[model samples]
Target: MTTAFDPVRIGALELANRIAMAPMTRSRAHGPGATATELMATYYEQRAGAGLIITEGAQPSVVGQGYPDTPGLHTAEQVEAWRATTDRVHAAGGAIFAQLLHTGRIGDAALLPGELIPVAPSAIPAAGQVYTHEGPKPYPTPRALTEAEIAETVDDFARAARNAVEAGFDGVELHGANGYLIQQFLSSNANRRTDGWGGTVEGRIRFAAEVTAAVAGAVGGDKVGLRISPGNTLHDIAEDDVEQTYKALVADIAGLDLAYLHIMESAGMRDLTASLRARFTGPLILNPNTLPEPTGPDALSLIEDGTADLVSYGALFLANPDLPARLAAGGPFNAPDRGTMFGGDQHGYTDYPTLT
Candidate 1:
């Protein structure tokens, strides 16, 4: 029987354990040009015990940034800064992947540079507020992408994947979930275009497929992964045909021979999860059941039962630096500080005590 403690293979890389640290936004990328700081390296180094660590969402381009202080993977300085963190993690015997995210309609212009507004498949505004340096503000109506610009956006993801490799990351994961740019195109309500980028199921899934193929072309397919959420309503997204949308999306990309497919599961979507699990022939990483609590020790059984190839933890891994050791011991884990979870100093960032 497989346990979370067992080793798993993702592409050419061999993970030490099946327990993975999910990508989370800590809002602590406080460097110039959104470059990673040495302090950030310390934070990841502390958690190097995990089999794999997926870093926070990094904007692939300047306009892709949706929040203040998030990191990027588009420039030489940014790549050079990230190389420090990746070098440290590799030295500590850990594998890391940079998640390339483009927040289309979920951002405010104040968060971006040079007065550039958010871009989406359509001009609709998400019905919520995004946090900025000033505080929380309403989401601005995004400019719709032109047909030429859509091709350019795909190129941006490919370029970022190349940049990620240059920074010494083991791989790159496309942020297709969580109401970001990729999901915006997948959303029925958010994406109201009639072009090849949106409209029917095939058109809606086109952008995602193109980006995946482009990234795979840039970085080998074995070094690429894609994350998705079927029925997630975050950022005021609504999917009338959630099942059809994701099944088609999975089928379209399954032949890419990618590294993994990560699903951020929502409430009562286990059947859909099972279907996707069956359709996708690669390694499947599941952050299961978004309801009563964060993914807990109980989810370890998902691996034993073959429901997931690897299990990802967000808050649990954030608070417990040596989470795998704690789990192996049936742990008395430390609780995460909510207030300091976002943008703060070392109090909640790297100050979490590990069970020694």
Candidate 2:
């Protein structure tokens, strides 16, 4: 019987196992010019037991950044800095993919260069606060991107994808999930534009599909993946009629034949996953967002049952460096310290001891 420990092929890259390390922001990019530091390399290399390591969200442009200490890929310096981390992961026999993220309206001007206000699909303020260098502040109403700016944003994603390849990453994953820029366009409450970019399901999905196509064109189609969280209301996004919107989205991008579609499991979305699995004709990575319960046997069962080709773990992979071996043994898992999950030194980042 096929198991999560079995090998799987994601696009042109061959994964040693079916377990993927989901991207989690560590806010430890303490290098000059928002570059990835050697500490980040050591951190990823320690967790290289994952079949595929999806690095933390990387801002594609200066204004796209949402948080402090997060890395970027727009400049030559950023790309060069990421190379060492990718090289370390590869040396450890792991395939790494840089997750290109554009935070959109989920940002604060205080966190951006020159205090640049965030741009979103619409000029509405999210119903929550965003963290900045000063502290947490209420989300400011973002400026809507003009048609020309939207085009430039698409080009930004494509350029970031190319930069990931130049940084020695095996591939790139577009961060279309959460309530970020892509999801900002997908949500009805967030995207109220009247142009071709909004007002309908087809229009709303246009930005995501166009971004995917452009990235795939810049890199290889098989070297690109997308992550989506339908019905996710994070960052104050209101995704009314999630079923209709996501079905249209999946249908629109199915023809792209990209590497994989990563779907985060949400409450009341099981049937939607089933429908999406049938609709998308490529590999699927399921992120079972069930916390407290360890993603050990249950996640493998998803792969065994054909609901997902692979499974991704976030906190488990963060605390357990040799997660594959630990899962195989099914004993003695380390608990992650919530305090150090975000910004921190090597204490919780690279000091996790592997089974000896």
Candidate 3:
């Protein structure tokens, strides 16, 4: 029988344990596209003991960037930068994946190079101003993407997946949540298009399905994963029929042979773990998430009950570099300072010490 802590195969990859390093944004990219610095590389290398590590959301293209200092896989230099990090993790006997993200309406074109109009499925602007290098600025109304343009965006993800593999990553995860482009298409409020890309359930899901197919084809379905939140209302998203919307997505993507379906049980929504599992035939990684800082409330029990194949943790990994050791030993954790959570010195980034 398979246990949560026991090694299990997800698609073509086999993991030593079931604990995963949840994808968290650190915004430490050394300016330009996705140029990860030595410090960023070391930060992930230190936590290689986990069963899996999912890096912060990486924009597939320049216009996809949400934060000022977030990383990207759109350039040759950026791929080289990530190669060092993935090499380090592989040397440490770890498996890692890059989360490909496109901010879409969640960003401001003014903050991006050439003021790229921040395209989305519709022209609706995200509710709030995005924090940029200069400061927070009101989000500009995104120009709706033409049908041909939507296809181009899907191709961008395929190209990024190839870039991720070239950068030495084991696999790639499609960031389908938190108000990014993928989620925008799934959302009724954000995506009001009447064409092939939006309106009805299947229409709204067309873009995501195409992107998933594209990435899977580029990087092999066995090596690709997707992260989603059913009732996630972030970034001005509003999904009317949460159950129906996600059911279709889970069913449609399962045929692609994805590694695992990562569902984030975010705030305000009824627990979706059971409902989501019904549609997915692959391994399931559950994020029984809490506030900014996570307290799992017997997170292991979910695995014990067979509700999830693995548990991906976020803030806990932020404060404890050796998160597996701390969980195994039951040691007091170091709290991450809010000041350094975004972008700054290594104070809150790599300075946290492992329990000795």
Candidate 4:
């Protein structure tokens, strides 16, 4: 039986182990232009022991931003800023993938330039609050994106993927999960359009398929990946037909021959994941733990049972830098500070002590 510490091949990239650092939103990009800073590079460099590192969600465009202080890939300066971070990860013998996120309707105008209203698949307002410089505010009803604008959004993702490659990243992962722009289109409640982009399952999955194909076309298919949550209700997203919807989605993108399909598992969604695994023919990275539960022996079991090719850990990897060695030795592991999990200085970001 293969262990999680063993080497695994994901598309054209060869990973040293089966462990992956899942992307978590750390609002520490306080650079001049919302670009990645030296501190961010240090944070990632410290945690470069993982087989793969999926950086925090980066907005493909200015309006794609949903949170405060998150990074973007829409500008040349941003790409230049990210290059240093990627170089550090590469020097440390780690492969990194940039995650492209468009927050869609799950945003506030206060976070946008000139108080620009956020855009989504439809004019629906997610029933929650979004973080802003002032504080948390109720999510506003986002403007419906026109068909032309939707096409432009697809191009934005493609351009961002190319920019990631230019920034020295190994690949790009499209954030199609967590009620963001792509998931908003996947959810019938959020996307009520009657045009070619909505109504049927094929229509709803069109955006994600197009975005994946565009990114694969921009970069190589082996350098592009996608993440999805089948029954996730985060950020007020409701998928009435989770089974059929995600099945259609997996089938639609199965032929892309992309790098991997990352699935953030919801509670009691193992059968759905298995079904998706059958539909997809590439590498599968499974994030089994949601909140509160720490990833440990259970994640390894997913790999041992062949349910996942790679297992992703978020909070555990955030807290422990040398997670692969710690797990192999079965010894001490550092606890992550909840308060410093978001915006903070080097204290919780890069100050985690490694096993000496």
Cα error, candidate 1, residue 170 (Å) = 0.4
Model 2: per-residue Cα lDDT over 196-291, one tens digit each? 999988999999999999999999889899999988889988887789988888898888788899998888788999899899988999998853
- After best superposition, candidate 3 residue 140: deviation in angstroms? 1.7
How good is model 4 by TM-score? 0.98
Clashing pairs in 1: none
- TM-score head-to-head 2 vs 3, winner: 2
lDDT at 129, model 2? 90
lDDT of 3 by residue, 186-292 (tens): 99999998887788899988888889999999989988999998888888899978888888888788789899989888765535668778778898998887534
Candidate 2 Cα errors over 4 Å, as ranges = none
Q: Which residue runs of candidate 1 sit more than 4 Å off their true CA positions?
A: 291-294
Pairs in clash, predicted candidate 2: none
Q: Candidate 1 on 1-356: residue-level lDDT in tens?
A: 99898999999999999988999999999999899999899999998888899999999999999988899999999999998899999999999999999999988798776868999999999998998878889999999999999999999999999999999999999999989999999999999999888889988989999999999999999999999988999999888689999999999988889999999999899999999999998999998856444445678888999989998989988899999998888888898888888887788999899887
Error (Å) of candidate 1 at residue 248 is 0.8
TM per prediction: 0.98, 0.98, 0.96, 0.98
Summing lDDT over every window of 10 consecutive residues in candidate 2, give the lowest-scoring window: 290-299
* Number of clashes found in candidate 1: 0
